[model samples]
Target: MTGYRCEEFFGEGRRDAASVMAYETFVLENTDILDYLIKSDLIGETMKELLFVYKTLMKEGMLIHTGFDTDYEEMLYRYRNNEKDRVEFFEEVLDDIRKATGVNVRFCLWLCDSPQECLDSHNADQAKHLKEFEFDMYDTSDIVLADLGKKGKLCGYEKLPEASCSVQMENNL
Candidate 1:
């Protein structure tokens, strides 16, 4: 391939200092846009993880749980002990980014508070109605949505359309 294939790295460790400073400034300047890209998954899973680590280690000055695969086992790992996995991944890549450029991107959920909820709604039966909403920044937890009334026991939440949700979340970013 003619490409350098640099996109394959876990932590490319090549974030230009100017780019870092620029990105930090951009994040500070356009916080909403950056968060939108994250919720929409515009940067892809790997870059999403990189940004997640960057956000935790640098910006917020605290770790967050991310980099989760939707597989049942991985979900279990994240669901049961997300802190450990997220933290370990952050720790593993923190120094490299520190030595190189810095962190990237924040978070936003156009249709719901968390990524899992978005996934849940995205995967739900097409018959359900979906809506777009955001949670208070202070509210970062997921709520179990059990079936009730005449619905089945595994009733799911309504979610925004997948491509539309991605676009909305990435509107300005």
Candidate 2:
């Protein structure tokens, strides 16, 4: 098993948000520099690693952003209700990501999905079901753990005095 990669987003603090925003702007405008950094340890080294290893059973695991209000579930339900609308919506997401990142990544419909859990079973009820992918992560909220960056922590991987379970969960994810 190897460590999974993640890039966190921040909302509140000016410093970390500014830093990340700068990097994002640079990557979006200067693809060459982004390419170079991806090939260099200078930027890559900023990626914080966790102790536990992730063993993705799938060849290429899908990452889902099921944030606030559990919209993913409703989004999937709507998409299934209208497949054509779903295609257009997904194309828009891909285009938005490409516009923002200058990259062409594959489109995997989240479908309230994870790598392991595909919806199956006789009963239609979904109350007691475990989501297929426990390996997914939420896109960071419009909140930044600013205090954690006192020692130059990027994703707040370093220990913080009053840490919550979410902090530990994010690192482990």
Candidate 3:
């Protein structure tokens, strides 16, 4: 809502003057549109822009793909063959997504090492439990369990009644 300053979100010394100016101009030109997206909750404050765009395209049925092979890949190949750079091709793609979903996507990408192991763990259930323990509380009394924590024990076992000690008491020396 405030003035468009790229350095506010990004760092001051990250981008050159020319790149910053261009980004600022773009933001200023699309102020109203950005405001609309923000107000509509289409663009969240902390949400990653790439994720938002992907979700929006999937929601709007714009990205028609089979996960293995995609039409978007063919589009990108054609654009690359036509001497179109990545920036231009992606700008067009973003514009198309914006026109379809009314969300203007912008994000700063960073390079990082591959975290395939972590990603695999997140994607699949990699639990390594040799034996799974399951407890059954069927027909259990509710009142007996009320003091379980304080007593530090469950109510399943109780002390048996002591045998009569009359014979032992009579034989006392």
Candidate 4:
């Protein structure tokens, strides 16, 4: 009734279906990002710039493939084929997503040697971005560091309580 069973019920083994579900969920959950961009009148410009950066990173093989969605695959393919107009591609996708869904979900991206490093990277990134957006920083670093230090490594779904859907690391790896 939970854990792997829940994952199985979601058809996790079927790449296409899982991907569609993930994308749909992402679109629905992050409507605020779209709304913010629209309100700031930076949606088109941001998308173009982001797409360029994404394509360049992909070309340099910096973007890791996590086997989650088709959009990533398409981006990879375009990068490999050298047919991607980075600016145009990113703008189109961002614009379409924004127009379709108005939410903007927070995303944490990090590159670190260890879990703590990852957390630090995430915090730093969040701080910088939030500041740029003129948003208040909650300073959750100490809490996160304490929790991760106590846990040792990131907690998997199985280790969490039955009623809890949130993801947490169990160890500080």
TM-scores, all candidates, are 0.21, 0.21, 0.20, 0.20
RMSD of each: 19.3, 20.2, 26.8, 18.2
Positional deviation of residue 90's Cα in model 3 after best superposition, in angstroms: 1.3
Best by lDDT: 4
Better of 1 and 4 by TM-score: 1
Candidate 2: pairs in clash: 117-132
Model 4 residue 76 distance off true place after TM-score fit, in angstroms: 7.4
lDDT of each: 0.30, 0.26, 0.28, 0.31
The runs of at least 3 residues in candidate 1 whose Cα sits more than 4 Å from the true structure, single-residue gaps closed, are 1-21, 24-33, 62-173
- How well does candidate 4 match the true structure in TM-score terms? 0.20
Candidate 4 local Cα displacement, residue 82, angstroms: 5.8
Model 2 C-alpha lDDT per residue in residues 1-173, reported as the tens digit of each score:
11111112222222222233233322232222223323433222222110000011011222243542334434433443554554454344334434444544231111111121212211213323432212323232211212121111222111221212121121211
- Candidate 3 local distance difference test against the native: 0.28
Candidate 4 regions with alpha-carbon error over 4 angstroms? 1-84, 103-173
User: Worst ten-residue run, lDDT, model 3?
Assistant: 164-173
- Tell how far residue 58 is off in model 2, in angstroms: 29
Worst 10 residues of 2 by lDDT: 50-59
Return whichever of 1 and 4 wins on lDDT.
Answer: 4
Clashes of each: 0, 1, 0, 22
